[model samples]
Target: MSIIRSERRNRYTTISNTVFTNNQLSFQAMGMLSYILSKPDNWSVSPAQLITVTKNTAKKTARDGVYAILKELKDTGFVGIEKLSTGDTNYIVYDTPIAKKPNPYNTDMGDPNTAKPDPYKPDPSEPTLIKTDIKQELKSNNKDLLSSKHDDTNPSDKNSDSAKQVIQHLNAVTGSKFQCCKSNINHINGRLNDGYTVEDLCLVITQKQIEWGSDGKMAQYIRPSTLFKASKFSGYLQAAKITKLNPDNRPVTLADFDDLTWGKDLGL
Candidate 1:
């Protein structure tokens, strides 16, 4: 029986076309939101807990500041909160696609009886190497069954061409001009974090696709959601901007990004 592990987090929804989500939040707001969302699943935290403990735990920001931070996250739709009858509010955490899996639960070397036919029998002259022994140690016995699923029986199929086009596009935005080849698709996939969509990557080069390479035009492969993520990584805010100002409702700017210690670490 196959056993899927219990998930630590769950993504209720994903944001696509986040181009509209720019500069909507301040850095402090972003950090607070990240903290809230990153908590382990099943561990629902209350606002009082946050107001008292979390507020001054890592960053001696403030008790009231947590409220403001949560408010900011809610505005962006990154996280939501609920008010309990106990008057203790709780943060609503969403799952991201980038969750990790535990190590292989089991493994099998191989079954010799299932070796190739006499004409193409396993090479009795040599031993198998450790690295190439099993693609997935856990499911080694079903190797052939697994490979048959993705078998490219026809290289000239229309579907095949479309798939190749997508790969080329992925290569470009990944800073891979001509690197990740068809055989390395899994490797590339492994590196992509959840929450990233092909459209997201395309946005990173959408302008470039329009612009000329030495050739003339480059294609875009990133999805809208992924692009928004990149926008965030690039210091671009989602439509959820929080100027990071105080309750005074003052305006915050890029200049004050690192100036204030609102969310500075208190060394635990």
Candidate 2:
């Protein structure tokens, strides 16, 4: 499905909020997403938007200060970032480096296929580089099959089943018409413009419970009615954005987040 652009841009605010809490990001990260969501969508918004927004709410210069926040937000799974080719000369070549994922159990760094370690190895030293690489490889393999029996870190595929579940949950939760400071309820239709079912929406709430936070604070950011002033419901994760769909062939012209709310004393 194609992205529900322009007309359906506000519901993402609530989606990002729930995503932030369930994923364990700092309030600063959450605040940044809240700000990005408030801006207008035009292909993409740059770091300049982040810098301006952060500096405004927080008294510090956001120029140098935006990256760490961006990284944290990225790490916490609050935002989906894509490296689009900007025609500007300075930026034309900037997206060259793709973040490499760890390779298979094979630990040969020189080989094109082996998994590189997390945080790529810098220009290596002259001494024993090959030996060190082998040792690290052996250790990594053994740690999984033999050495450490207790593996708490999830070894799940990031974009796999559970991840899809997480996405569905997000899509379901944000599939509501944000009660913005206007009387037009057209955006709050009973059927989700983004195509979320009631069951799918509840699963997100369940998933949120599975993921805990360090702060232990209850989530207040997703209350759409409570936050009807700044932005209304934006569309959910448009599958075109996440799925590998051919842009020219996608079905939905726009997947909307408006009209996703479950009202009080309604819908048992």
Q: Per-candidate TM vs. native? A: 0.25, 0.27
Compose the digit string of candidate 1's lDDT tens values, residues 1-268: 8988666487442333331245866777655555555555665544423433332245555334654565555555555554445322345654322222332642544565544332212256753222211112213222212222444435544333323333444332232333223443332332244343333322333232222221212223233233333335344222112321233322211112112232211100
Q: Rate the local accuracy (lDDT) of all candidates.
A: 0.36, 0.32
Can you give the lDDT of residue 175 in candidate 2? Answer: 30
Q: Score candidate 1 by lDDT.
A: 0.36
Candidate 2: RMSD over Cα atoms?
22.2
Model 2 segments beyond 4 Å from truth? 1-13, 20-23, 40-43, 56-58, 85-268
Question: Model 1 reaches what TM-score against the true structure?
Answer: 0.25
As for candidate 2, its clashing pairs are: 10-233, 10-234, 11-233, 11-234, 103-115, 175-260, 176-259, 176-260, 177-259, 235-257
Q: Give the Å shift of residue 195 in candidate 1.
A: 57
The most accurate candidate by lDDT is 1
Stretch of 10 with least lDDT, candidate 2: 87-96
Give the per-residue Cα lDDT of candidate 2 at 139: 30
